[model samples]
Target: MTPSTSTNLTRIVKFGKKPAKRDARNLKLSAILKAPPRLPAEYDFDVQHNGIPTPMFGNDYHGDCVIAGRAHQTLRFEDAEQKKILPITETDVLKEWHLENGGTEDGVYVLDSIKLWRTKGWKAAGKVYKIKAFAEIDRKNHDEVKSTVYADIGTGLGFSLPDSAMTEFNAGKPWALTTKPPNKKNGHYVYVPGYTKIGPVCVTWGRKQQMNWAFFDKYCDEAYAMIDAADTKKKKSILDGKKIDEFLTKLKK
Candidate 1:
């Protein structure tokens, strides 16, 4: 298959993820989930439920992909672990985006968004949701990316997208590595809840989008594994067996 030929389709969708940021205080995934079990060749937590619809969360009209990614991940996590979907609305996402971007359409840094997610939390369905913690993942490490999805830790990804991606997305095709260079100015964010033999699948623009491993390696610049507070409360969480409680305690020191 050839790359999309439409160079003028850059504005087809809104990309709200700002350039990647490095924070020294961020925890490493390896340090938290040590000696992770071998992962299955394929795993997916973004299973379609009977009535749930994949939401765009205001991403279509606003540059809130970062905030939208958070909502998508929350939906996937709650559906898989709690067996119930939280009513996260577009208004909730736009509200958070307004707070993060200072009431502007300007994008937000991935690290800053996750930090707020942990400390302040996002409000949805009359309930406030917060993550226990978030760990930085090596974007280039395919195994680590797959393992994170396999463990039910929803992965948030930031990418320096190539212009051709817009055309591919418009055509409902999986994102693939192209000879075209990545545009750093076009940073976007998405939530990855599963992986197939072809590669990791992400939710963006209110739909399930697939990307091959090469596309992921070429474009993904920042990655994170979020530990949901609700999952921690349920002892059945895969993380419960990993002794995350002890790890978090040590982190507080």
Candidate 2:
């Protein structure tokens, strides 16, 4: 496929809802449909380093292959009393699931307890994980409430695609139009195709913490010493679990 050829992209549209045994399961379904006519041209850069080029339909420069645009998506769910909309990133979704299902609640939710047990009479191959957390204020019996649930399965965190997903993405991975504005937390910035100053959000992880030596050797040492000289001095958790209190106490001597 050439960059100029038109390609089809799927979109989900919710029509109605269906019955489910669980109240949460009784949710709406979205039908995957073809996008509307007169869509914007999609454009992605083909520049690559030493890695092998990703799979593509045709020449990398075709407008038909590119679907460059902005998208603003909002996720809504009922929280006992009212609808709650949480704007989250792809990573935030995983964190949210862990918060909702795991014993250790996130900043928003507080963990109550967790139980783990085997099902078989003897040596069972799998174990069950059960967890409970504090309910929202609007939930029934909010002050005195408890829920027991189980997931009879194996759960683990794994990694794939050794290289960056951005590399694959820029190599003409067909995507949807996004209206989300770029934020500084995304790390890097780039101007949009038509919108002169509008930039997109992009971030990467797995980096080591580095200190600012020049600034560290400046105004901080004296003030730090004075603070450490106090009677109620306590250790601080620094990089890689190093403590500052012990070091400071020794320095004061």
Candidate 3:
């Protein structure tokens, strides 16, 4: 169903994030980075570069938020660290979604998506992109979330969304805690590449969305830090040498 904004513009949004899955072998952010750096009180990765406007990546018509979120994170990581924007297209995203989700419009579990990202990788612009590793984040720790963005580590969030979020999103307003109950059936995923003092800034439906910390804590059920292979090649300090080796070793098992 489409939701109308104050301007009477119809906004079509599709949510495809399933509830988070757990595995005992999954790496934890706390275990990887013992002490993260102190970051500025407010920071935004989007402002660091002049990339093109965010794309919906077919999210407007399909339940491909998982793949769309990956595409968004790839754009941000390439622009910020590689100094170039990857030409990711809607077709490219949908192709990956089909492969990962078995050609279904049904949603995906965040863990399964990340595993595919690390193993099979995704193809965009005729090039394959892969992440070196991924670790679960403490979604309740506001400071940890901020630090991940500041450090240039890509972050993906999976959350149960409340119905009122559609109105707030259509109005281009920050998502805040509301009395409305969250609907797990509306599980959605977004890539958060930046944050301001108010809260994390996520890319969804081709727009930059800001959500307060309270709202994040309330609805954000799963969070992860994706270490891009390029970042590792550049020696980005997502993990020290010893820790990265240990982490990779664990993943191999």
The lDDT of each candidate is 0.79, 0.16, 0.81
**Which lDDT tens digits does candidate 1 get at residues 157-251?**
99989988887888879999578899877789999988999999998887889999989888889999998852443223344435556666777
lDDT of 2 by residue, 56-138 (tens): 21112211111000000111111111233222233332333333334222111111111111111111112111111111111
Instruction: Candidate 1: list runs displaced more than 4 Å.
Output: 1-11, 48-51, 229-253
Candidate that would win on lDDT = 3
Q: Write the per-residue lDDT of candidate 3 for residues 126-235, one digit (tens) a residue.
A: 88988888888888788778777877778899988887788899888999956788887778999998888899999999899999988898888899988875244323
Which ten-residue region of model 3 has the weakest summed lDDT? 1-10
* Candidate 1 residue 137 C-alpha distance from true site, Å: 0.7
> What is the TM-score of each predicted model, taking all chains together?
0.87, 0.16, 0.91
For candidate 2, give the lDDT: 0.16
Model 3 alpha-carbon drift over 4 Å, by segment? 1-8, 229-238
